[model samples]
Target: MSDYVTYDESDHVVTLTLNAPEKRNAISTFADCDAVVEAVRRVNRDRGVRAVILTGAGTAFCAGGDLKAMRDRKGIIEGSHADLRENYRRGVQAMANALYECDAPTIAAVNGPAIGLGLDVACMCDIRIASEKARFAESFIKVGIVPGDGGAWLLPRVVGMSMACELSFTGDQIDAATAKEIRLVSRVVPHDELLPAARALAARIAANPPEMVRMTKRLLREGQHMRLSSLLEISAAYQALAHSTEDHKEAVSAMLEKREPRFTGR
Candidate 1:
């Protein structure tokens, strides 16, 4: 219910837009990331929401964690209240984990600047599509702090260790085209068409069976680290699970009939 975060649904896609554009969509001192977790949870289990697209309102997608908020957190740490800092740390990590574990397909439509915590959020998503106006940076080094949330873990996996090191160490921003070239984002569209493109992609994903889609995402994330033989074993188990769904029967029947299968996600 944060005024800073707006949630809406179109067809089967749920969109969460960072609504605080006036401060360059900075998710600072306010409870912005916590609000995001709630919104995503609301959409995650909702049968009507088969896919999700995350973006920012106004100019920049997010200027990263509100610097002012970080300052306040530093003040708390300096106060020698160890318990308080630990509790706050858990809250922040929860927000990052929510973005990572969201069951449906998650897309970050980076319509503008993404710095610090903003980069964490974008990397947590399953896919990223940026606008030509988008600018990306891992700004922790510039502020003389390590990435407080999940950036340390996610960046290296998205980009290789060497490239991730360079970005985090320098804190220089990269343009959308460069982001795509580095595989930080999958595609870059014009600013005006960013949301439209994201929504179109969401629709295409939502057209598939929800059960299979969820399993496919789970398989990719959980299976990435396993050996080839392990993956083959797990993949067969996944296919067995997929075969139990009514959507699978419909797909087979439709193939036999030479028609498109309309999956109900049941």
Candidate 2:
């Protein structure tokens, strides 16, 4: 994994921290994207990891792409037009896809600014919790570009098309309160409480059977794009598989015995 991202695991929850605070944790190069992708893949491979919290190392969560790199045509931004397109596919786009496809449910703990690609990355998570100091903006337009990191698809799904259009068109930054009002974040907490809140949430999710949580997340993702009937069929299959697990039997027995379930993730 690249040094730009740090991975920590505890109590079945994995925390992925963007480590570069000097540039406000901006994803500056293809290596940065690879770091994020590898972290997500690592979590997916570990069945014991029931939840993931994504946050940054210092004040800012992520300030989006490195502006200096963009201006100087350096890092991922350095290339011909065709080369740039390919770069995106291998870099930011790959990171986005990895997060979206991650088996463990992801919670983006937005500690500060989430601008342009940063906002898109937050949207890629299954849930977002923001700090009071957090700010969000669909700011690619301000940089004379569109949402090349899948913001166009993600923002609309998270905040509705009209709100996405307004944010994308204006490129105006919204404080945590406004972000919560528009459903960009599920909730907002004090700056110091951000990580704690995220961990608490992740812990709640991790308390359940790990396999069930993964299947449930998969079902939710599929439901977003599948027909209701098709989703029901898939759900039925998942339910049948779930019923066959040792954890499922333990859960049912615990309910009858009036005790907490001891799930083995079977």
Candidate 3:
């Protein structure tokens, strides 16, 4: 919606690109936060969208907060202590919620450095694909601030508590290889091949029945905080709904006929 973020859709995949290349795609202003949340909302409600990819426009995937803004007390940084807490709630935190709650599977194609809030943004995605030039850090500490955008919760879930603690405490940037080794990114490709790799994975995910894909993602998200018994109940309900869809019937019929399934996302 804003110049801070741009949206594109093709072949059942929606791509949301952070557009402020001059700022290294920083989520500094309210418009930046709103643009991301709006884009995620759009993709979530579009049943035709089976998957989504998030990336940046230029060299850096996202450099996180605009240090200039912080120094000048402009953008999100311009506020009293209570005002700043509220700003986090309605701004960056809301963006994180929109992303994590999105129905379509999300892949973050980290083209370059993803620091602080940017790193947290990548962690919010279900999958991460990084460029060879990509780097990552839970860098809030470096700025004498903590993760105000839910990084404390999201990062630990992504890279595990010990590794997350190490990154957050030190605010050290890690190479793409180290990110992959720590499970921060599922794949690392050449800088030029980043988007293609992410799209290929998205296409693979999109080939499935769309409703099933969404429901499966929902189940996975629920399982993260749910007990085994509660998750099983939720899974059973979702399975019933999935089994009753026309796409499920088509899938089975196509298998029986030895043909590729054509799903209508019913």
Candidate 4:
């Protein structure tokens, strides 16, 4: 993508790094959001990509919107009321939609402060792994603005409604330890080990059958909003497709032979 974001793929895993350390990798302008959306689209289209790891370049996972850009009315914060609504829908909202719907399993490696939209970004991922230095906040209300980037919907689903409301109302920053306590992050590692931990997790996921991994993630996403009966129906449909993959046959044979499975993304 652009210099704002960097994309790299290796060993069935794709890494999308927010590259703007000068702004703490802020999802500031439409271009920044576009970069994220494009990266998500790229990995989702690549069947070989079994997992994705999203993290920031420097110390901050993301600092949310650029305060300078907002103050100058130069980015998403610019435009009239109606125009701004459309801007958000097309810009940040679109980015969220892309990541949330991406079929590949995603892990957010929260390296540092993930505030405002940054927190929402982590919630969008399938799992979140944070550094001990990492901090999080749903601080939109502190700036007298709502979560224009879907945080209201994403955060509650993550930490539950009571915790979500408390964070949104207080606009307070919680450390990585507190985040883990509330189930915001699944794991917290030393600052230096953050990326390594995330990659290790990604590698474990990448070792599975690629098609089954993607389909399983889709089933889980759909289950979040569907009835139990509906989810079971969808699950059955997905399982049938999974059962037909060549990789599935290989996996069964490997188990029977007591050998590691070799999957060719079938």
Q: Write the per-residue lDDT of candidate 3 for residues 156-190, one digit (tens) a residue.
A: 89989999999999999999999999999998999
Error of 2 at 226 (Å): 1.1
TM per candidate comes to 0.92, 0.98, 0.98, 0.98
The whole-model C-alpha lDDT of candidate 2 against the native structure comes to 0.94
Off by over 4 Å in 4: none
Per-residue CA lDDT of model 2 for 1-266, tens digit only, reads 47999999999899999999999999989999999999988997888898999998888999999999999999899879999999999999999999999999999999999989999999999999999999999999998998999999999999999999999999999999999999999999998899999999999998888899999999999988899999999999999999999999998899999999888898
Pairwise TM-score winner, candidates 1 and 3:
3
lDDT per residue as tens, model 4, 130-197: 99999999999988899988999999999999999999999999999999999999989999999889
| Per-model CA lDDT versus the true structure | 0.84, 0.94, 0.92, 0.92
TM-score, structure 2 vs. true: 0.98
Question: Which sections of candidate 1 miss by over 4 Å?
Answer: 72-88, 227-230
Q: Candidate 4's error at 115, in angstroms?
A: 0.5
Q: In model 4, state the lDDT of residue 96.
A: 97
Candidate 2: pairs in clash: none
Higher-scoring candidate on lDDT, 1 or 4 = 4
Question: Per the 3 Å backbone cut-off, how many clashing residue pairs does candidate 4 have?
Answer: 0
